[model samples]
Target chain A: MAEKKVIHFKIKRQNGPTGAPYWEEFKMDYAPNHNVVSALMYLREHPVNVDGKKIEPVVWDSNCMEEVCGACSMIINDVPRQACAALIDDLEQPIVLEPLTKFPLIRDLMVDRQKMFDALLKIKAWVPMDGSWDIHRHAPLIAAGEQSVRYLFSRCMTCGCCMEACPQFHQDSAFIGPAPLGQVKMHNSHPTGKYANEDRLHAIMGDGGLTDCGNAQNCVKVCPKDIPLTDAIAQLGRQTTMQWLRDMFVK
Target chain B: MADAAVDPNALGERYHFLIRRLHSLSGIVPVGVFLCVHMSVNASVLAGPARFQFAVDQIHKLANLGILKPVEVLFIFLPIAFHAYVGAWIWLTGKPEIMRYPHLDNIRYAVQRWTGIIAIVFILAHLWHVHWIIPGGTEFDAHAAAESAVNAMASLWVGPVYALGVLCAVFHFANGIWTFLITWGVTIGPGSQRRSGWVCGIIGVVLALMGLAALAKFKSMDVSALQHPPVTATGKVEPGAQTTGH
Candidate 1:
């Protein structure tokens, strides 16, 4: 008879935003091709600790089982990444899961990434063009190379991985983090969006804006979409300088 | 939405924005540029004390620059005072995770902040010894100035202190150049940053070497003659034994 193999998990569980955090260890029957999300789902069904006590099922947030949605972001094995993409087979035994530290924790492994969204609003991370009426264009001539670069910036899923790793993104500080800054680069690059470039630049020129970034460059390394965050920041830095000079001259 | 978008007052005063920009600009143009010239000029000591004194005299005797006092005050001292003030605020507030993060850029950021602090202390001490406490006062001749610098570096502790100061200042300036580019949007992408990294690294190494060489030159010279007649500005000749020999 073959021996039963089991997966071990050490999850940090919290009841609510202000709840005290505690750890619970679980052992589950080893399943083939199980990722963190699947393993978590199995734990939800079992809800038994390593001591064999039935407990409340662990809760987390996820929309897509794939890595695209960016909703299942958590600290797995001390790295901030999407739980959907973390393979149980690849991770070390006694795998650890924690909520993203930069955001407010909802429960167990779920975090509220509202700060990142709010920053997007602050930076106006969208093109000004509204679909009030359909306008025809002869050709929206964009070079392939330019499209490729734009595509890179557009892939940002607001995962908050960059924010989680950033040193400047703290509770007491007003830094808008790297995600929205990249969004600035994304929209600012668009042919139509360039019309609102001044507004975007001004948005980041104030408190907790571009100047707050300490140039740690941690955002680029942790980004799942491989967004060029540092590049965006540098570009924004230049844009803000130009904006400041222009403001001095004009206003 | 129009009010929210258009109202610049939502952020802070326009002066805060301008001051922040000035802080970055001040570091690069007047302060950084002046440090480069100052270090290169100090490197003249490698040719011998005569050459060093000659170089110092040329700077001291600039004709068009109203007086050395005004030029030093406006260009060098004022910028440094402002940079130090703003830099101190930044250094205090910055929370570094180099130990936990340990990423390459994280380490660089930590070191840059730390070096900025050390460089501030170094600059203060250098000014006190070189500019403030001259034996014949601030208007001392180039020879007297060179003699005082040599006398100061003659000590074991002071030599290493000046060396460390120079190294820290050079590192700060070099690393600062890289950040300045990124902050100012001059190096907008990773490729450009990588290239600029190489250039900044070379500049740092060269400047550090020049500074160290200047110190070594001071260390090697026999200034027993200058030490004997080391007269204070108040016409008091200091004890000869301290400066006479190594």
Candidate 2:
């Protein structure tokens, strides 16, 4: 039988967020369904390049070994995707791997996505559970339609894909980005979450809040969960109008 | 003492001030609100010639009133001009890399700003042709004004330009509405914000299509019987044209 095919990989390596980045190449025996994460594992076992010299084991991050966790996110062939799902056979020769550029580099393919999380906090993207325990005990059940809308919003993994794709989200920006806004909508719809609704609304009302979104719909397009971002925005418009009127009269 | 405190990053503070001011002003009333009104007014075209003409006449009368002109100059023209000016300043000062990449944020911002410029041009030309150029002539007559509007609508140059202007205006307005909601804290959470996004997107497309349809099917008017008789300083028509007046 002829010699089995081999897979070649080129990865951009960074020591830390402020450290210099460099490229490293490796060749491994091809397996029909081998993925980038598996290849990296293989490299960990036998750390050597095509030139036949031993080297340091490659560094990267992974938790779920599945796309759901979003911990394995990296730029493969210049496209941001989870390494666990990127099949080596499907990728072009010399499969390139790099860290997600939208976040601060931790090391190698690892990045700090804390900014996205911080945005979630800034938007107060949570429903208050207070009074809900008593209310739900006596309340009428949710309708199928309401459940479906809630279900759509429940899919957000805080994966930062929407933030990564957003033009308005950047290092310099205080703009909370799209994912957090979706969270705000989800929480506000909750019976308990509605209590803090005014506070949430007030937070986003500032200059760097929702006003920064340019509505290119790029976040929606890139969202893996198919979240209805633009719809939320429109509803928020009417809600804010009502809120504004209510605030004027009440306070 | 609190008010007298100076920020070490004075440049940043200054930049923030300008940005916040522009951002706040841009959100006020929003372009979408104006587009909604414009579309509503234009939809009157479907009510047949007399009603549409009467509506137009009423608008002209209201606009020409001596007291409202300065208010119009201040509120309508000044806000738009200032918005454009500050937008340009922001664009120029922004990182050049942003211009090169044309990311979604940059594209949306650029498109909105450029469309404002386009709208300004369209508004000026529209005002010149319909209000000043057509109405200022000795041949100025209602029939002639109606004919000019129809002619402008039918022209190869004007037809496409108007259609494009309507599209741009609607898109700009809808996008602005979406952004305005965010600015005002309506879509603060991740879930609701995302949901609001879809709503804005759908409305933007729908409103744009509606405006486009109105412009495309606008009915042309007959102007052969147009006659102009002299009027007094108080704008009262002479006896010969008194029957056609008002």
Candidate 3:
């Protein structure tokens, strides 16, 4: 009888945010269409390390178990990505996993992504509902070009990969970073949000605001959602200038 | 003192969260947008002092109007406050050990943040020296006023400050411009982003030099006329003729 094939894995482990980080190896029985997350689940059922010793169940955060949620994001072979989408067959042997670096570590694979979310709030990354709360209200018509731009921005899943890959984003930064700038582009594109456009412009106009970004472009490359962060920043640049001029003259 | 009353942890929790949000969004305006305008304005100096001064006067006039002044104040104050507040907050909360290294990416990021600190100091000093101190109504005569302006520029202390300010401004602007392009999605591909960075660096240096030259010219002018008063009934107004020894 032929032996069943198996997949090997090496994951960086940490007990908590402040706990010491270490490595553990595991081997999962090969199955068709298996992904990193699935293998992780298998290990959860049988929490044993390669050293032939029983260990605590590996800890990680995942919601959708699919690529859409972005909850299963981690570093695979030093590249930030969604674990759910990483196929075992596609990765090199001894698949490695680590938490995204740019965010605060929560545990083994979960990192605090509140910074990215907070940035969204700071930028007012929303269209003011105004009188449109009623479902019966007429929806605003969006031009095709505008729609395309908004669509590009809508892809952000609040995943921290962009932040993780960004060199400028760190524990010591007040840099609002690139992800939120993309959100600025998203919200500003909406007809309703355009009403408070000047406010949004004014918000990012300060010290640690847009000016803080060093334009490394690493954020866009690592964004799982493929949002056009760089483009949003440029548009905001032009928009803010107009706003600055308006603020100078009108009020 | 008032902040001391609040639970340090809770205060951190509430404000830290909001500040992170504000910091992230703040990039769209002052730093990102302002850099573009600043660079373009500095470029005008290449056209000569008249054009540069004209632009400055126009900006001042527009910015000084009643309603506009408040808004302008907000524009300047909010971003600086938010950026500084958030930056300090992050520094306080963040683990600095991991960031102490000198990777290329890390070095650039650190430099950018440090420049923010430098720019903030320079800006405050600039406001004090130029807007408030020198032009705030010390000199009664035009010549004296001009002399004061020139003297301010020529002073050993002030010269380095101006030079540093220009350098910091250009570095900040160039770095922000490079990031602005990426955040906006203008330079997506690796090749494009790298090329854009190079272009930004070159342009930033040129703008910095132009701004420095403009500032340096202010110091090079002859301030002798300023030191001397208008010829009076006497062959020349004694050094102490106009009492108060201005």
Assess each model's interface with DockQ, reporting 2 decimals per model: 0.48, 0.11, 0.07
**Which of 1 and 3 is the better model by TM-score?**
1
- Fnat, model by model in order, equals 0.62, 0.09, 0.09
lDDT of 2 by residue, B75-142 (tens): 56666666666655544432222333456654766687677668767766665655543364233234
Per-residue lDDT of model 2, residues A1-251, tens digit only: 99878999998988778989999889888878899999899999999977889988878888877677777777787556678888888899899988877788888888888887777776677765544345445543667888799788888777777676666676766567788888878888877778778767656655555545555556676666788775666566556556656766987
Per-residue error for B211 in candidate 3, Å, reads: 20
Interface RMSDs of all predictions?
A: 2.4, 7.4, 9.5
In model 3 chain B, where is the ten-residue run with the lowest total lDDT?
A: B137-146
TM-score of chain B of 3: 0.64
Off by over 4 Å in 2: A1-4, A20-23, A49-55, A89-94, A126-141, B1-65, B85-110, B117-246
**Alpha-carbon RMSD, candidate 2:** 8.1
lDDT of 3 by residue, B1-246 (tens): 112323434544334424444564565467546555655554554443334444454555554564545655677666766766765544343232224243454456566677767877886777666553325532322223334556557667777887898788678768766655655445655567679879989977777877776566656655554333343343233455332111
The worst-scoring run of ten residues by lDDT in candidate 2 chain B lies at: B1-10
Q: Which run of 10 residues does model 1 chain A get worst, by summed lDDT?
A: A132-141
TM-score of 3: 0.56
TM-score of chain A, cand. 2: 0.87
TM-score of chain A of each: 0.96, 0.87, 0.93
Candidate that scores best on DockQ:
1
- Report per-prediction Cα RMSD to one decimal: 5.2, 8.1, 11.1
